[model samples]
Target: MPGPLLRHVDALVGVGVLVWNLTASQFGELSQQLDQGLDRARDFVTANLPITDAQLDKLVKQTRDGLSGSAPDPVGGARTAAEVFGSILLALVLLFFLLKDGRSMWRWVLRRMTGPNRELTAAAGRAGWRTLGAYSRGTMVVAAIDAIGIGLALVLLRVPLALPLALITFLGGFVPIIGATVAGTIAVLVALAANGPTTALLVLAAVIAVQQIEGNLLEPLVMKRQVQLHPAVILVVVTAGTLVAGIAGAFVSVPIAAVAWRILDTVQRHRAADSA
Candidate 1:
């Protein structure tokens, strides 16, 4: 990665960590509450339900067995961590190599081709890159707007884990239609769990309001000329991507659509010019 891009990525990671720390503190409290509620519910059931001593003893034994069985496996956890870290390392190495040598590599490939086909290929590549770059820049702005607006709203409402939820909302903005909705739902649920129904409702309204503002104002202002896809086209692509490849597809579909559209547009314009 270039220096500026690396700096931006580091900043985003730092923000994520900050949000995680803030929300993790609140998460501890929520965990304790959940444990206490479970204990109370268990006691109430034990007190009210009709059961024999033998049955109760068996149930207790079964519960203990289940708890033991469910205990975390350190070896498995370590293996998973190692796998994740290794993948990240590999990706970084590959990206570094690509960034260092990508232009020469592309030119080498282009040199093997001849005639109009080569020109068309180069044009399509340029258009795709331009489209992707524009989308990335615009999405960053939109994500910032989402994070700030909803984060301030959560803070005003005194919602616990607000920063973490806002961070999630910002990241989710990268995905097309459904990302923010899913993240906002998590925020509302957190509010409901930590506060009360009234607070939860307020959080829900706030989430909706923020999304409305993002869709109507921020996205239009930031991404208006970046991506040329219509609303219906976006919706269809999002739906198809979601259905075919799930969350990952939904996240990437818009960019891929933009690139494809750019390529097509470039081809058409070039052909028209050549004819003229």
Candidate 2:
């Protein structure tokens, strides 16, 4: 097997083992905590809202039955696994070819264009490439900061599975806004289950503070230099990408938008120069 493929396989196995151990040790405890929390919530709702105890009980029972009836199919699980494996294989192949032939490929593309258009295309391509590189580096820095900040809070709170949760946060950071939110929610829930509501609230506060700093300070400082984008534009692009292509789309949307913007800016400048 190729080195990249072997590395990917190793990573997958490591993650699987980590997840298995976490589930094996903590599943029962988490479930118990969840049940207790739900009971407390039910009581509070019954006292505050216009619902009767009997109605709340019926609603809870129906929800549980529905969840139980919706257990995942083994065949579907196997199929999804196969699809994931195939995607990894395809990505590896593409990466290898791109690494090996990128310059030649770019030259080939340039050869297909003519005169000023060729120069414009080359300039735009270079700008887009630079934007992508900047985005990747800046994102990694931001992600690392997020993971470290939250992971430290988890450790201070004595949360279980802190390492694995931190790893998830780091990976999730790649997906931008949605990714961080989901990862933080998981961390908060784990804190609630293992510790209590107070710990959970602290965890929530930590997550929010880290995310806000990353969004307002870190990202603007790191990304604005090369990949200038408004927060509203980023949100819109992320939402549209999610609607169109789910998680994969969300992961890629921001970089794609940034690169596109850089390329358009380059083209416009070239056109203006010619006109002048």
Candidate 3:
């Protein structure tokens, strides 16, 4: 678990750095576009709304000044960094102990149980573990496919920061439906800002095509056997998890659901066999 999670964190950091560099390199052009967009917005508001040009100008100025304000407090930043580091350290220590003693702990639990109950417990545990493993592998395969498909389209469209965008897509693919949509939207916006409407539309179409293939074809083929949950069920589970616990909940929910389903199935099968 920590292995895959650490890799994800690394990927996220890489994507962030790449995106930051891309944005920095294109800052001048982006600023010009922003100013032009603001001008258009002001014109539209002045023409259609009750607001005066002076009021609009003041609002825009305030917004711009707020955005361009001084950097964040170093002390607060340091405190946040320390907290993050402490959390990571604690996680690593827990991971170490779990890795070292998990099997022994499982055996101890099984030893305390008796007869059919022990057998059922063992079977359910094994099933849940297998399901979780299958989910991890299947998700990675699907994410790779998404990243590759979207990256190729961006390359063909000559979109700037295509690689970083593709990396973002790959990372987003881990979160299932919602992640992919957000990543695609970011790609479309970037294309629109950098390459205009036609290219942005093309990118959007490609994203949709890739996502369709992922959802309708790749997911069913790759994940159905492992997860065994309906698309709607997965969607609902993800949504509930997100509402309850944000990104961490969303990330873990599907695997938890899959494992729980497998465990229940295992227990039911054993019960039926024993009754028969």
Candidate 4:
């Protein structure tokens, strides 16, 4: 709606596109390397495996038939893309509306409630929003640190496509446990392809170190201000969330838990005071 907002959005869109294109190009090269390796492995297996000529021919035919039967569906792909784009557009519109009138909407909702329920609702809303904001900011800081640490490590080791991989790592950090693992694996694979297994192992170590630091130091220090959760509790909730709702649940589980705790604490204190 404003010039500054428009400018910020434009800049972010440009940067996102640039990063995506660079990463996609790197992935294309990586895919080719993977294909070549698979081909070599297949050749070796065929050469060494004990089988009659007719049996080998039958096996190859069966594999080819299976692959052909599982051909990519262009229509399905297009439909999925359209659905995703539509959902994104809808979310942006809703976000804009919320930003424009969120306070008024909240006030109106509060007015409709009565007595203790209204007060409790207001308190819960405040706590929930605060937890969400704190978690969002702290998570970004942690992700930035992770990206920088891993990216610098890659650069020091003379790994190719360090920046693109770092960008991916940063984005992946938002997805919680699975995201970082997948991103780090990609970096290791790239290192293995460009350098060697030795360099790849080194990269793997660096990734593990960075993740440990983030989990042990960065997250606790920053996130404790808003939400103090035991590591075991977090693990259980995260696992449950991932099972229930995939990435979105994993991303939000902690914040939701924190907010719920805050609300319960508030309610308990209110009850204690009323009794006194």
Scored against the true structure, residue 97 in model 3 reaches a CA lDDT of: 75
Worst 10 residues of 3 by lDDT: 30-39
Write one digit per residue (lDDT tens) for candidate 2, span 1-276: 457966976896897688667656665655565566555556767999999999988988999899778655899869877876898799889877876678899999999999888999999999999999999889988988998999999999998767667777887898877789988987887777677779889999999999999989998998877897876897899999988866777888999999999999999999999999
Over the full model, what C-alpha lDDT does candidate 4 score relative to the true structure?
0.80
Per-residue lDDT tens digits for candidate 3, residues 124-178, read: 9988988888888889899989989999999999987776677778889878788
Best by lDDT: 2
lDDT winner between 1 and 3, please give it: 3
In candidate 2, position 137 carries an lDDT of: 87
Q: Could you give me the TM-score of model 1 versus the true structure?
A: 0.71
Candidate rank order under lDDT: 2, 3, 4, 1
Stretches > 4 Å off in candidate 3: 1-88
Q: What TM-scores do the predictions have? A: 0.71, 0.76, 0.71, 0.75
Clashing pairs in 3: none
All candidates' lDDT scores? 0.79, 0.84, 0.82, 0.80
**Stretch of 10 with least lDDT, candidate 2:** 29-38
